[model samples]
Target: MGIWRIGADVLVCSRFTVSPLAQTMAALTALHKGRADPGRQAWLREHLPAYRDRLAGDRVEELLVWAALRPRWLADFMITPPRDDDRTFHDELRRVSETPAEVAAADLATAIGAPLPPELRVPDLPGRAAALLEWIWTHTVLPEWPRLRRVFEADIVSRTGRLSTGGWAAALDGMRPGLRWLGDGRLQINTYDNPPRDIPANARLSFIPVTTAHGWVTWDLPDRYAVIYPCTGLLADAPTSPAPPVAVSALIGPARADILTRLSEPRSTTQLVALTGQSLGSVGGHLKILLAAHLIHRRRSGRSVLYYRSPLGDRLLKPE
Candidate 1:
């Protein structure tokens, strides 16, 4: 068990963030491990071949093999990562370029748990690592990011609601199994490397959710400690294409019924418009009715308002 002693300052400064690079790395790790929830595994099996074909001449496959071989070490490079907010791939790649060479080498050494190979110990190691990651991001993750991000953002939305309703303990403990808030400012984490440590009062704590993470991966960075945990209910919540039952479709117009069915996953007005090919105004109108009926709930994510079916909505759609 690992204990993170949270000080008052740390508690106040902590936040929940989504990291694209982190998710990409976690996905790569999952692919490497060949262990994922059935849904994610199925996704990988179907999509990985296309991703590999896109790689063509890139060395991303080799890098994935190297990183997979030393999971702990490769993970350390992402510790105290440069990107913490919703940012672009280019922004994170630039941050990787700025990582000090010595710092990269030391992290690499720790990850390898042995002397670094001469080639990998060079001054430009960080740059090389960055390039490999950049290639991986461009070839494998970027195409699927839009859909994957919705899952991550929705997880954040759900957890933020939990935090508001239940306070810190409930929010933290409920993230995943094997994490406990052991009152008195102590958090117990069940980890393979169970070393107890204290987080500086001034340091920040960030909780990041990723679709690819099977459980949780913790990183002690220079500015804060981060925990990357699996986002729950992603596959189960993904939208399906089966048409609503005839009686239900008759109650609500076919358009509204279709909209409700597609809302199994949270979607923005724009997304709904694109998915259903309905005009923005039409989608908005339907959403308003659904909201009034208490059949769907809307939450604001940045500039976008995302809507999802409420429990009542789910019940109405279910077969009688």
Candidate 2:
């Protein structure tokens, strides 16, 4: 009964703004060409490779940012559209302060103790607050600062005071980190697999360790949590053994295919075992091959290794 489970297909759209209302307005702005920026092209090339499929011909970075943020955005937190009847919503927020965005953004930054940029403040409020929000939307990925990202996420969940998804909550509550992920040696990062760029090249990456006391914190806050990134690739010297290719062909077996197929949607290993009627050892073996193939994947979800097919795996399993 965790939150993520409740909103399984809620479609958290991407609007680059902090608030959901801002995301909608931003979406409209893009449709009418109000938020165009040329620098976005370079930014995409430098940061997110996933944009390749979405932005092949158009250098429409602003629109993409607005789109991405809008989907997952909360409705009330956003800046109201000039066309909407949001005067009351804006005023309600204003009751806390004339510039609620500035206040919320500042509180988020402070809770994390990260350096605040000027964008986080209200546009008219001459300071670093305004700069910070601008930077987050434009130039950076929040997870790059693991500790700080968790702080901001937690604070947002607290201030919003919305009901938990039951799915997400259950997932976070039951998630546990283990040395050998689902018995496969491959590492798993919960929300995503990409390593945050800020981790030093020399720093050996490992799980933040679930039992380390810090893991007991409420899921309302954002932190690295079950999200993992592959640090094995970050080893100081190249391995003596040749790395296996991460192509789909490596996962060619009935059990592997069945597992990958079921994983197109997220499923706990326990769930998969029941659905597929496979032994735990066999499923674990198949998962390892898929992990090396970069096809099927596992993540720590509230002490469980939730397995799912990678985006790439989905296309391969069922080609359009």
Candidate 3:
């Protein structure tokens, strides 16, 4: 049982972020435990074999066993990663390389609660840990990131909507099943194995939604805190490529209908053009009309604008 005390100042200061490195690490943990959402399980069954074939050595697996297998050791090093509009794999690996050595050693010692292993006791342990993360990124996660990111970003958008409409309490309660929102500025989380601890007031809490984490995971660093929770509705249907529905096409025209279907995963205008084989001018025109009708919403990611179907649009597409 962990209770995070939230003062008014902390509540206002806290924000949401998405972390690619966190998701990659969480995915490795899921693979090792063989536990995942049903949809993700099916995805892994199909994709894991190819991912393993691409591994150059057993270094990544060894690191997973040594650092990530248990939650505590990795928690020290996997501090809440800095957020960005277009955070990339290389960018995060660079952050790993920059972790302070003392912090890494202290975290490892505390996590193990015993004498350090011979190999890990070597000088420059931070560099070695960073190297292991880079190896995992290069071999396993980078290839699938494009597909995984869409799920992560979409979850953020949905949660943001909940936060706006019903305030923090409503938003936090919806994140996972067992979370408890005790009124008067406190939130209690049920971490099965972790001992009870109280987070001090005024600490900034970062809530991160991850596609790979099965349940909630937390990181308590100096003045910053983070909770990584599973993304809801991800892989629930595991959409297969399908033709646009005739009824929708007739109602909204073929091009508009095609655009809406492609939004099952968030996509940019250029991506849509490439996928639909439509001219830029034609796609832009359809997008304008769709946006006017509240059938889709757009958000910026780096230089590109991403569009996903709105809740109204989702209802319209449901089969009779």
- Number of the top TM-score candidate: 1
- Could you tell which candidate, 1 or 3, scores higher by lDDT? 1
Ranking of candidates on TM-score, top first: 1, 3, 2
Candidate 2 off by > 4 Å: 1-251
Q: Cα miss at 71, model 1 (Å)?
A: 5.2
Residue range with the least summed lDDT across 10 consecutive positions in model 3 = 55-64
RMSD (CA, angstroms), candidate 2: 17.9
lDDT of 3 by residue, 190-278 (tens): 54565555555656677777665345545545566777777663535444547788999999998899899889778766556545656
Q: What's the C-alpha lDDT at position 234 in model 2?
A: 15
Model 3 quality (TM-score):
0.68
Better of 1 and 2 by lDDT: 1
Better of 1 and 3 by TM-score: 1
lDDT for 259 in candidate 3 is 90
Q: Which ten residues in a row have the lowest lDDT in candidate 1?
A: 60-69
